[model samples]
Target: MANFIKIIFFLIIVGGIGIYFLSQSPKIFQGSPQEKVSAPSQTFVSPAPTSYTSPSLSPAPQAISDYLIPSGFSRGQLSPYFEKINISASYAYSHFNPSEIKLSSNLSDNEKVNITGWQIKTNNGEIIIPQAINVYEPSGLFPQQDIVLSGNNYVNIYLSVNPINKNFRLNNCIGYLQNDYVFSPSLPQNCPTPSRSEISYLSGQCQSYILSLWGCKVPDKDSDSFYVSIGGSSEEEVECRAFLDTIDQNGCFRKHRFDSDFLSNEWRLWIREHILDSQHDRVLLFDKQGLLVDEYTY
Candidate 1:
């Protein structure tokens, strides 16, 4: 029994020594003084983009006044002024012979519009037009800027679209001008030609070789196919309006529909010259005042 008691005392003393030693030793699994616990790595994420907008896609500017201005007055300090106007986009149809577009407009309702100007917009966003403009009257090309009039009615105006662009696209628009003063035909009449850097696409003769660089063809002045887009009753028309409607929606020109006699060297040459550049998808039009008028995207 005495030996057993001695053994127990010995075990108790040894245990205390072991415990003290353990307390002084550095920890490994639970982080020692020199060791550190590594945290999980963090990931990075970018913020989403804000609203998308294009400066080039902004809408064109409009004239300030709704009424006709007197002749001799400048448009907001410019030589030729465009008055309040509206485009008859629906009734716009193609015209041939001289290669022009016959567009009807409601201009100077309270006053007759004698003088006018225009520009052409191509599918590639670049205007294929010259700076020179020729105002026309019922008699033909009017050289003098003279007018005798009563206003408030629809007038038919002509714009040359004979040569389609490389992309087979074109838009011609007449600008409506206005200013402040007693406007009258008696007021010294003259529409001086504006000087331009590039050749105006609108100045060329349809079949003449001098204007051949423009790649023009005789247009189908008789066809009313594009009318469906503006509310023409296709059901009552000669050609099926539904089929015509398809072509209009797609904006494609069918050779058969344009004119039955389209297979000519002139037509072929025009097509070859005015080949559309895929890189240029937008065409823009500006008035004499250097303001945006119209744009076409193909």
Candidate 2:
């Protein structure tokens, strides 16, 4: 009986030690089958700035044919070249210097020419901004104003694409043509070009002066810009070195980005930083008092 009792005690001690060890172990090591290990969470890292994916080029080309304006013919003069549009949206117009238009004595030579009467021709129709050429920021920039308002104190007027784009629009669809990269040194090597046949965004537009004037001409690769330059006879003619087309998108992109592309360097950097910081993004904020407090992603 003594021997049996000693054996039983030994067994009990061994069992208790086993139980304690088991208790101290992780649940997976214990006999319970219910324990599980979860996957580790992951973080995302942005690719290098040069990691831009090659834009696709498989889209069918848009059909456009060009008819030249004879060298002797005057442009906007014979064309009556204003396509009508109303750009007076409350959000669009701000810091209106009526003084600029009223011919303020304080205006500089550059400031004296605010691009008021110009109409931007688009595939959707005409877009007009009464204050284009003079202001630091044109009302046309408002389409992307969310981006501008997000990080900038003030965006330059040249950043406004709608007033200049051949498609009469801005946003993702807007990108530079081959020429814009040439003349506008500010445009990066990767300035977005159309990968598809139906290029959507354009930098700006000009009117064809009713179907009768140029008879539906468009810009080709060699085309340059639109201007109301003094003709050989000294008459102002609305002309582009290459004629532009709104409907078919010929001569459809800007050879040069806005002359003001230099002004937005800080703004561009701010946008990039915001994008980098974005797990998601927000660009604007206001105090309860209704004044803008911060913009761009915080």
* Top-lDDT structure, candidate number: 1
- TM-scores for every predicted model: 0.21, 0.16
Against the reference, the lDDT scores of all candidates come to: 0.30, 0.27
At residue 211, what lDDT does model 1 achieve? 27
Candidate 2 whole-model C-alpha lDDT, 0 to 1: 0.27
RMSD in Å for all candidates: 23.0, 25.3
lDDT of 1 by residue, 70-162 (tens): 233333432122322222211122233211222222333343333234443445223233222222122223243322222332222223322
Off by over 4 Å in 2: 1-173, 177-185, 188-288, 295-298
lDDT tens digits by residue: candidate 2, 82-151: 1110111111222221100001112222221122333332122232323312112222443331221211
